[model samples]
Target: MVVYEGSEEQTNRIFRALADPTRRDIVRRTVSGEASVSELAAAYDMSFAAVQKHVAVLEAAGLVAKEQRGRERIVRGRPEVLRHVHAVLDELELLWRTRMQQLDDLFAQEAEADAATRPHDGTPPPPVP
Candidate 1:
């Protein structure tokens, strides 16, 4: 599916950032509201630096943003990016749905043709020409 917004590199970064389970969780957590990097690190077993790296990756993807609030780095989810992702997925779903409908219509037409060629008396149909 085609995304109307952002360059290919930006889209690739977004998808790459989301490919990780930890990153996805981070997005989910931050999306609800803002959270400190330390607070996020606390939720995971990994080191604080690891969490920071994840946040950096997310920041690079434009999926999340971090701001310094005094001594804490508060991370907030970019709802707009999430909305864009949803829109892209919706477009893909629509494309697939349309294709499936076309296939169904084609199959129905074939079925109708097959039925028309069958003998009403239940005898075997004629061989292919």
Candidate 2:
């Protein structure tokens, strides 16, 4: 199982919003710049209402911001949330590197023990061709 090291509540909301492909698509589309609801709706096969709902989920997660225009709502992707996600992943990476170093040390110790058990005097093993 994979563990996430992020704010339990906030990360839960972020992940929930990202779980849907349509919502993820909406995010991708807005990365270039903010787009109106009708403009975003045209990019996907889903109904405009469905795309609006996806935008709502992203806004709730603070992954996107929606501004009220005269008629349409403009949705923009918030990249800062993704930077937070990257930071959490970096923390997990540090934990994994520490674990890997410990495993490497254990393997080296086992190799030394095997060499100690070799026949004849305790001399270094000949280099392999």
Highest-lDDT candidate: 1
Q: For candidate 1, lDDT tens digit of each residue in 26-96?
A: 99999998999999999999999999999999999999999999999999999999887888788889999
TM-scores of the models, in the given order? Answer: 0.91, 0.78
lDDT of 2 by residue, 1-129 (tens): 234454578787997898898888888888778899999999888898888888988998888999999988999998888777667778889999999999999999999997776756757767669
Each prediction's RMSD over C-alphas, in Å, is: 1.8, 5.7
TM-score of candidate 2 against the unseen true structure: 0.78
Q: Highest TM-score: give the candidate number.
A: 1
Clash pairs, candidate 2, are none
Per-model clash counts, in order, read 0, 0
**Which residues of candidate 1, in runs, are more than 4 Å off?**
1-5, 126-129
Q: How much is 122 displaced in model 1, in angstroms?
A: 1.8
lDDT of candidate 1 at residue 43, scale 0 to 100: 98
List where candidate 2 sits over 4 angstroms from the true fold.
Answer: 1-7, 120-129
* Pairs in clash, predicted candidate 1: none
Candidate 1 Cα lDDT to native: 0.95
